[model samples]
Target: MSEAEASHRAIARWTSRVIPAILAGVAGYGTYVVVDRICIKFLYQERNQPAAIIVILILYFLFLLLSLWSYIKTIWTINTDTGLVPLTRTPPSRASSKKQSRRKKEGDIESQPYAASAAPDSDPNSPGLERFYTKEVFICESDGRPKWCPDCCNWKPDRAHHSSELGRCVLKMDHYCPWVGGMVSETSFKFFCQFTFWCALYCAVALATSAYSLAEIIHEGRPMDGHIIAAVAISAFFGLFTFSMTLTSWRYIFLNVTNIDMLKKAWVYQLAIQVPRGTPSTDKYTTITYPLPEFSSPQSPAAGVNGHATGPTSPVPAQENVSSARDQMATKTFAVVRTEHEENPWDLGWRRNWEEVMGTNIMDWLFPIRKSPCARHDVVESEYAMGTLVNTIKERYGLDKLPREGSGGIEMRDVPRESRRSHRSQRS
Candidate 1:
């Protein structure tokens, strides 16, 4: 097996093996606690004590089974159901493959980047046009070179390098968390949620059963209240942490973007069908729309078009196919729609505007404790306003070219209103 595959097996094996052992340890502890409390403290050992002991034993066994079921289900979800795959599983686009072949002939590096081309000549009315959506994806530079997989023979997507350890491209991957016995994602989020709930549940059940025993112990002059309190406190803390993570993850899912996309400030673009301006087409006949700015400023995050979202107003049909390259190439035109990953207007260095919208003390509320000097007011304000410093981004968004009150700013040059109207009309 390849190193990557071997790593994956190791991960799977450790997870499958180590996790069960931990669960067994927890079960053993629970048994010791239950037996000590019931047999030594709670059971009276009088003539009628044996009957009460039998009833308690039956209930304890039932509770243990329920706890085991929840634990097993959580482990099962973590080990499977997450849509991870090896780089070998990722298929390369034909264009990427051709590029690699040509490069190899010239004795260049053998690997190809993970991206597909935009079909500039495409039919807007064709059903097969959505493949262009995948074409926009680009590997983020922050992620290092992906391990070369014999199956893929190309570079993998961003945040998706081969884990010689896991042998799969983990979805919503952070790191391979061994404690839970596998990779992390929505599935693991749910698993953690259930695990926390089960832990709290067991804690409550244990405490309640032990309460009467503890009362007797106190009557007999032993203080065990501290142990019960400690267990309860730990349960509360774990529950809160697990619940908060679930909500944050849900926000990322709704945005249709990943955490990496937010930090890097990048946009995905694809070539699409071209059409004549001022033509109306239903989404069925309408191909995926793409945006092209006249000029995009490298320095500004806010200086790009805010592309609109797309979806069918009507129900879509399955098994639809179109291959009329001639008709597709002729009638369609490209337009832009911003991905959900686009930086918000507030993210640009528009501090006054941000303070106005989010309120004067927004930073304090958003980031409490103020632990890092880098996260100070001036730094936050500057990074947020960086895009507004550029004139191109401001003009594209139809904002004022220069700040009305600033002294160190550019002067506005006048153009004929008629020429401005013509330019605006052309854009439409």
Candidate 2:
């Protein structure tokens, strides 16, 4: 809005274009030196090694082609998951009465950005539990509310983080990479990885050939040229940079985590519990020594394994419930389940995690030839499967050990380490 701010915006837009051009110019110059100075002038004419020149040039062009294709695709890539989830069902007859009778209440159930309509007997204000874990999430607040993005005015999808640069919520959002010329979200992620990988290979080839050609000139007492020297230096730098990027990208891909998630260290299970109002004492909370059973594959969708629905859509499972209505009017609150271990629920083992991001085939891993399997099912089917830590906790305590489901009792709460230590000191 201010003059300085407007100028800054203009400068940013110009730099975005300039950076890509500079990169392209550097790569172009490297290509020229490799093809013209090294292959044609030195290898073909002076040394008269047509076969060697042919072989080197063939490899050079292949890597160059792959790098360029991936770069272009990544720049132009658009994600499919960017949009609002409009109200799917109309509000019922009591909507007017409720609107008139009830003011905006604190701790009101958070409406989901894509919450399906409530069933007839269900509280209209309460949206269904988020079943899918891959992208869409139902459990948001500790009290089982979906996360609402104030800026985006929608329920932020699972792992969807708002990018400050892009000013939008990006699903499985990664950092904004200048080399790729955009924020690497779910769509452009694969192409970005491929571009870095192919470009690394491209630089390696250029560096090797240019260094070899320079060696030949040195052996023959030929003077060095600036062009060949620049090629080697450029290739070496780019090679290191791209190689590092490739390693980081593939590592996260293999682990089934994103750069943002890794930065946040938000790999813990965001579990929930129910409690009544009026400051219920912590005494009502019970610490079960062990966790409940890992909800098996045949369980209700709401009681999904690692937030992924294991079975067909069914009504919320008949868990331990209170018979009286007074006990049922409980407020749900959030708890974080943490162990003295690092566990990523999203990790489906290294191989399966790789398949989730890059697809199954070797070609798919090496090149951006096809969209990944995760791309198709970003909505519901793809899973955020249960992990070892969760299973460990579940195995510790049987379901019978947990509190009655609707009793408004805190079933699980991970007290901070400091609190636990202080409590132990007092006891001592």
Candidate 3:
């Protein structure tokens, strides 16, 4: 390796080792201030109040140990050495066989589904996941080609995103988080959320006790202990931080979304339609946008390889394919404009969404006792987001006239309504 590359690696190794020690020291110091300064020092030793100290210590240690255990579990869940989080995998994580894990060991993150582009017959070791392909495998374009990630040189499935940090496509990757020390992705997301939750409670208790003690001291016209002051500042800082984190993490999880998905909400979702270059125009076709728009949409594009322009702000390039469909017929791409509310097609409603990431059992929540359900290529038919997605697909391709895509001629609106009813019934 080059000298500069070696130096960078060395520095990274050193930082990784030292950073954990620094964090552990901070956690240890906070624990000391709460248990030693507030609980034992002032309440028990100075005031001789055993019952009060006992109650406070019990509560304090409960949150503390729970938070610590959760943090460790989160770290364990994302362990780079073990391929704890997914690099790629076929089966849902909770159900991954030992042979499957051995084959795709990197994929152990949350319960969200991940369908590998690898066909079952391509690799001898392939676990049979049916190699489900989404609409992405066809119409989506980058460099005028369908392969989603030019960097990874692969056709990514729906919900899979290329993580420049990890240098590969992550299945349902949330974000890279340093606080929990890894990618808050499909595998480790639940552990990370639980960690934040327990930490929020821990910090809340720490802040309350320290602030209460400080208030008591001031009210009595007594000086504050330095350790008590330090504890209060640390507790207050982490309390607000953890509380906010817990709220945001669970919010995304409950919505069955990742931070990446949130960022791409406004990007035009386009599908390239290929037809013979001399085909007659069909631009009069109309799209019925959901919560249907206040104004009607512009006419559909004339069938061509690359010609019709989209909205002024639309990012769908007025570019042509140099490969594939361009070898014969022309291509006509359509932008399926969706309102912000309907953008996410993965939302399965709150309960299933939550269960997808965090699991459905008490022990699943209480402990890091199980893996999250791996993301499936095929979302359940009852999912609201799935309905929105299927609805958009139906509208974009003029499937309204063709009954082959779905059952009967149920209006697209009926799909989400049925899904909503399903959610309501299960919720009830």
Candidate 4:
């Protein structure tokens, strides 16, 4: 490997392994300091409350155990699911090959394709489609199909991205957290969320207890202990930081979006609207651009579009838009286009989306004991699934409705009148 690659590997090892160890050591030291200085020195020895001190010590240890377990589990799950831990396999023999072929034949015989026109709204028996919605329908922009990661040497699953840090493709990767020293991925997301929650809770409790002890000392006209002051400062800082992180993580969980998704909005939009090869030129590829919500900053432009502002704007001519019949036809097809805000195809309503990641069980939603499956399992399936979120959106907006022969192309009726007025005002 090159010098740069070796350096990166060293950094990854330190971050993913050494940093976590260091954090654990720091936490242990902090616990010792708190128990010695505050709990024993102030609460028990001075106040003569041995029983209360024991109970408090027990609770602190319990929180520490939970936090440590969650952190370790999160890292392990991420590594396992992201293919960071390589599995050993023996060379396939003729017998194994024959068995695989036989299984493939049996599988093909049992499977049946759903009709393109069928949707969850129209079809009563389309639960499978809805279950596997995100994976089957979402297409990559590179070739207007599910993409193969050259580095991983495998078909990239829906929402999976190649992580340079981990040297693998991670499913639904939120981010590589330096604090945790690992990638927060689909498999580990729940545990990571729990870890943050626990961290915040533990810190808050410590801060509260330390503050109370300090306040009592001051009221009794005692000198402020340096150890107590240090404990308070550390607890306060970490408590606020962890609490803010927890809130941010929960916000993403509720939205069913990832930190990476938020950052790569333009890329996601580009992937969603990629037109398949051999699609008829007369078929208008109507891309609905949604206004960025008030919560999110409008700072990124749509793919292939040029504008100073982040809002959706007209498509600029690119090298890809050559003077081919298909390109010419696409231009003509959308000659009288009506721009509307595009909804996220992956958003299957907040409730369904949350359930998709966190599981349907309320207990499972609250706890991180059980692992939740990835959103889209059938990554190798065809372009579109019958009852998927994408299909549902298309059906609701009449996007799949055939264009009239004399009409320019697909007519979108959800165009906002306010947007048009704004356009007019800008022109004037």
Q: Give the number of the best model, judged by TM-score.
A: 2
True-structure lDDT of candidate 1: 0.39
lDDT of each: 0.39, 0.57, 0.55, 0.54
- lDDT for each residue of candidate 4 in 247-338, tens digit (9 for 90 to 100): 88888876777887776424333233312222232333433222212233323223212212222334446664334333233322111121
Report per-prediction Cα RMSD to one decimal: 16.3, 14.9, 14.7, 17.5
Worst 10 residues of 1 by lDDT: 297-306
Give candidate 2 misplaced runs (Cα > 4 Å). 1-13, 78-139, 265-269, 272-341, 378-389, 396-428
Candidate 3 residue lDDT tens string, 1-428: 22443464465546545666776887799888878888877888878988977877888889889888888887777665222223244332233323233433464321112234221222212221112211222223311122234233344544566553444566667776666665567777888888889888888888888899898888888986888888889988988998998899888887777787676535333333222222232453222111111133322222112333232122233353123222212122223222234355565678888888788887887677676764323343221225246465556555444423222122446646766898999999
For 104-204, candidate 1 gives per-residue lDDT tens digits of 45642312332223111122322212222223222211111122322244333333333334544444344455656665543344344344444545555
Best by lDDT: 2
1 or 4: which has the higher lDDT? 4
Cα error of candidate 4 at position 22, Å: 2.0
Off by over 4 Å in 1: 1-16, 39-67, 86-164, 186-188, 207-219, 223-428
Q: What would you estimate as the lDDT of candidate 3?
A: 0.55
1 versus 2: better lDDT goes to: 2
Per-model TM-score, in order, reads 0.41, 0.65, 0.63, 0.62
- Give each model's clash number: 25, 7, 18, 4
Error of 4 at 328 (Å): 30
Which residue pairs in candidate 4 have backbone atoms (N, alpha carbon, C) closer than 3 angstroms, thus clashing? 289-341, 289-342, 290-341, 290-342
